[model samples]
Target: MYSTIFSHVGKYKKEAYLSPLTIVGEVLMEVLIPMVMGLIIDHGIRKGNIGYVAGMGGLMAVMSVCSLCFGALAARFSAVAAMGFAKNLRSALFRKVQGFSFANVDKFSTASLTTRLTTDVTNVQNAFMMFIRMAFRSPIMLVCATIMAVRQNRRLSVVFLFAIPVLAFAVFFIISKAHPRFEKMLKKYDEMNGKIQENLVGIRVVKAFAREEDEKKSFGENTNSVRLAQFAAEKLVVMNMPIMQLVMYASITAILYFGGHMAVNGNIETGELSSFIMYVSQILMSLMMLSMLFIMFVISRASLQRIYEVLAEEPTITAPEGAGARARDGSVRFENVSFSYYDDMGNLALDHIDLDIHSGETIGIIGGTGSSKTSLVQLIPRLYDATEGKVFVGGHDVREYSLDTLRSQVAMVLQKNVLFSGTIRDNLRWGDENATDEEIIEACRSACAHDFIMSFPKGYDTDLGQGGVNVSGGQKQRLCIARALLKRPRIIILDDSTSAVDTATDSSIRKAFREKLADTTTIIIAQRITSVMDADRIIVMDGGRITDIGTHRELMQSSEIYREVYDSQQKGDDE
Candidate 1:
């Protein structure tokens, strides 16, 4: 997991390596400064040798300046390396998600992915920054300071052996207790973010239903939960500092008491005893740095694992090697097909089904909710692989064609009409980026969207706010249809795409499909009988299986489900 995540430090290898090298220079200078100060005190000040004092003082000044420069360079390099690494990691994650099948996305969920991309990546980046600097400097400083301290006064240095273990045990205890709590906190973050996203997306609904206070109360509860989780995790982490400070002060006090007595007895010089005290502080400070680094690791380890989970996830669907590109025709055939989102036959969403659709045929499907009409069309583009049996697009099995090749030829306007935050022209260009203005206008005309679009001040250039919030529901549906029409695809599936529009506009769209898309196969999934009554063939579905297939008039006489639906609509129209 560490190898996979850290491998994203791609082009910043130079900075990543250089940062620690500079940090080593900084540590070396820092270690030498106290030794120089001792020489100034013992040889220059104590002996009244002013020249020796002046020379050594100059050297210490130079060392301090060099240490500052090295510290600054290390900071710059580490920042660049960490930020660059995070950029690559986030890009890789997004690209991986783009390749994931619907089943794979459903497995992890959108909210969890968002957390990994933003907050989790940020955490890993921070840890990497601390790791590069402290990981090298702390241990190097600790060893060098300890050696120097022992050389000055071995008896005084024994204090560290005792102090070190105390700090080590404290860090270990905090890390062991805090890791699971941090993991729980991150889960809470996911839940809070999910609630916020859901509420923002449905803000209009909440307002229309006069549920603003309810939503506010729910959101407040979610944020409070996140706060409590964070507090629980941080409570243990905060223990690290007080314990470290206690150890440091005690170590310092023991060093001063023993070194002062040694100096009084002439066992250690005044300069040596002063320098020994400095070394003890350095030794204790290094241990504290290591403890802090450990705490950082404990916090980021959970984030790292979460990121690795995404990085390691194999996309459930992948294009077969040596896959074909072009479809033979728009013809699609399903033979003994069954599917379950969970890949269990017992829990099938689409039961064993057999059907064939000829190229360029207009087939209309009518079903109540949960009938899996959307599931049936999703297979044509290989959005999901059938759990059992074969789904063929053109002639070969759907899996035989590359996903891009199959999907390019199949334009699916899903049940949800989604338009991005861009100009109408930009949205339409998704169908055919190179589509000419004339072609754009024609597609809109075919979808009966041109008149309403031209009514806007900027016409095609008018910006559609996020999710096309600037437009009415019916307008959004029409714009989406126009965008799909611009694809000039071999197969087009409209899964309740026109439900927002009035019946007159719906009728016009169906007429336009007949006149303009004559050579293209069209499948319309709808609740209204009028939407499919005029089709060459109509499929009536119940549960997961297709119960009947016939023309409107033929189904009225033969299929009880169809006749009941048609009669109900007829009675409603008369009323």
Candidate 2:
């Protein structure tokens, strides 16, 4: 996990190296300051050697300035390195998500992925910053301070033997107890973020239903759950400070008492005893810093695991080697295809299905809500691979072509129309980034979206707020259709895209397709019989299997299901 995450340090690796180098210099200078002060006390103050004291004080002042400079440099290097690492890691995670197939995305829900990208990355970044600075400094300070303390008097240094064990055990115990709690706390954060995303995305529906009180109650519960989890984890971590301080002070007191006697007996000088106490303080303070590093490591370990889950996940779908062939034509063939979102053969969303669609053929598919109409079409673009059989597009298996090469030739306007927060021109440009203004207008006209678009004050330049909230449902659908038209793909699959438009407008769009897209394979999935009645071939599907395939007149005479649907719609139209 560390290897994968730290690889993102990239160009800032120089700064990462420099941070520890500077920290080492700072620690060395800090260790020498106390020794120099001891000289000022022993030789200069006691013996009245003012010249020696003045010289040592000035040296100490120089060392202090150097230490400050080193510390400041270390801080800057670590900050840059940490921030760069975080930026790279977050970008890598987002790119990975973009490459994930539908199944991969469904496995780790959107909310969980969002949490890993933001909160978990930040946690790891902070841990990294602290690790680089303290991990080296603390141990170096401990070793140097211990050697100095022992030189002054080995007997008093023995107090560290007892104090070190107590502090070590405390750190070990706290880390072991707190780690699992931190893992649980991060999971709580995922849950809370999921709730917030859901509520905000559907804020309109919540208000329309007058469920404000219920949503508030639910949000409060989620927040309270997070607070409780955080408190539980922190409750154990907070024990580190008091335990460390207790051990530190007790060691100091033991040194002060025993060394005072030694000084009175003239076995140890007063200056040496003072320096020894200072070394003891430095030693204990370094140990305290080490303990804090361990605590931070424990917390970041959980985030590390979460982040690695995203980083290590291999994309379920990828272009095969030497697979750059584009589709030859719009022809699509499904041979014994079956699919399951869970990849379980027992639970199929698209059952064993065999169908053939020729280039430029107009095919209409009608199915009930769970008939997997969308599932069958999604296979053409390789959005989700067929679980059982080959889905052939342009005379080759869909998987034989690179994803970009295949999907670029297939324009799919999905059931749930989506328009991003951008100007109308910007949204349309997604289909063809270099589309000229005339091409944009022409596609919109064919989709019957040109009138409404031009009706706006800025025309194509009008900003469509988030999710196209400024437009009605029908307008959003038409705009999405226009966007797809801009692709000028060989195959265009409209999955109930015109459900929001009036029948006359829908007919106008279909007529425009016939006139402008005569050579393009048009697949329309619709509920209204009138939408598909004029198609060259109509498919009836039920229970993940095709029940019938024929032209409207042929189905009306032979297929009872088709006949009943037409009669019910015809009666309704008459009434």
Candidate 3:
């Protein structure tokens, strides 16, 4: 896990190296200052040698300045390295998510992914920064101070033996107990974020149902769970400070009592005893810093695991070696194709289906809900691979072509039309980035979206709010159709895209498709009989199977399902 995450510290390696090196320099300078002060007190002040005192004091001042400079430089470098590490990590995660196929994406919830990318990465970054600085400095300071204390008098330094064990045991116990609590807290964070995202995305429906109180209650419960978990983890961490202080004070008392007797017997100088006490303080303080570092590592361990989980996941779909670069034409063929979202053959979403669509044919598919109408057309673009048989697009197996090459030639306006937060032209450019203004205008006209778009104050430059909230449902659908039209793909699948528009507008859009996209294979999935009645061929689907396929006139006389639906719709139109 460490290897995978730290590999992203590429350009920041220089900063990572410099941060610890500078911290070492600062620690060394600090260690020497106390020894120099002891010399001035014992040798200079006792012997009334003013010159020695003055010289040593000047050296101490220089050392303090050097220590300060090293510390400042260490802080700067550590910050740079940590921030750069986080940047690289987030970019890598986003790129990885973009590569994931629909099956891969289904494994992770959107909220969980968001939390891992943000909160989890931030936790790891902070832990890394602390590790490079304090983790390096603490051990060096502890060793240096312990050596200096032993040099003053070995008998007094023995007190640290007992105190160190007690502190170590306390730190270990607290961390071992707290780690699981922190892990639980992070999961609660994911839950809370999921709630927030759901509420915001469906705020309109939420308010319409007057469920604001219920939403608040749900959110409060999630927040309370997070709070309780955080409190449990922090309560253990807070115990560390008091345990450290108790050990430090007891060690100091033992040192003072024993050293005072040695000073009186003239075995150890007063200056040396004072310096020994200072070293004792430094040693314990270093140990305390080490404990804090350990605690941070324990907390970040959960985050690191989450991050690695995402990085380790191999994409379920990958382009084959020597894959074809371009599709041959708009023709699509499904040979005994079957699919199940859960990979369970017993619960198939698309049953064994055999169908062939010729190039430049306008095929209309009509089906009731749960008939897998959308699922059938989704296979053409290779959104989901067939579970059983082969699906061929443009005369080659769909997997035989590169994903980009195949998807580029087959444009689909999905059932749930989506538009991003951008100007009208910006959203339209998603279909064709380099399309000219004239081409964009023409596509909108073909989709019957040009009149409404021009009515806006800024026309193509008008900003659509997030999820295109600025427009009505019908307008959003029309704009999506326009965006798909901009692709000018060889095979265009409209998955009930015109359901929101009036029948007259829908007819106009279809007429425009007949004139402008005569040579393109157009597939329309709709509920309205009128929508598909004019098509060259119509398909009737039920229970994930194609029940019949014929033209409107042929189905009216032959297919009972089509006849019943058309007659009922015509009777309702007369009323």
The best candidate by lDDT is 2
For model 3, residues 1-575, the per-residue Cα lDDT tens digits are 89999999989999999999999999999999989999999999999999999999999999999999999999999999999999999999999999888888888888989999999999999999999999999999999999998988898888988998898899889888988888899998999999999999999999999999999999999999989989988999889898898888988998889899999999899889989999999999999999989999988999999899999999877789888657678898999999998889999999999999998999999988999999999888878878889888888888888888888899999999999999999999999999999999999999889999999999999999899999988899999998998898999999999899999999999999999999899999999999999999999999999999999999999999999999989999999
Candidate 1 backbone collisions, by pair: none
Maximum-TM-score candidate: 1
lDDT string, candidate 1, 443-508, tens digits: 999898999999999999999989999999998889889998888899999999889999999999
**Model 3: runs farther than 4 Å from truth?**
571-575
State the displacement of the C-alpha of residue 145, model 1, in Å, after optimal TM-score superposition.
Answer: 1.0
Count of clashing residue pairs in every prediction:
0, 0, 0
Task: Give the least accurate 10-residue stretch of model 3, judged by summed lDDT.
Answer: 321-330
Q: TM-scores of the models, in the given order?
A: 0.99, 0.98, 0.96
Model 1: how far is 213 from its true place, Å? 1.1
Encode model 2's per-residue lDDT on 339-364: one tens digit a residue: 99988999999899999999999999
lDDT of each: 0.92, 0.93, 0.93
C-alpha RMSD of each candidate structure in angstroms: 1.0, 1.4, 1.7
Model 3 clashing-pair count: 0
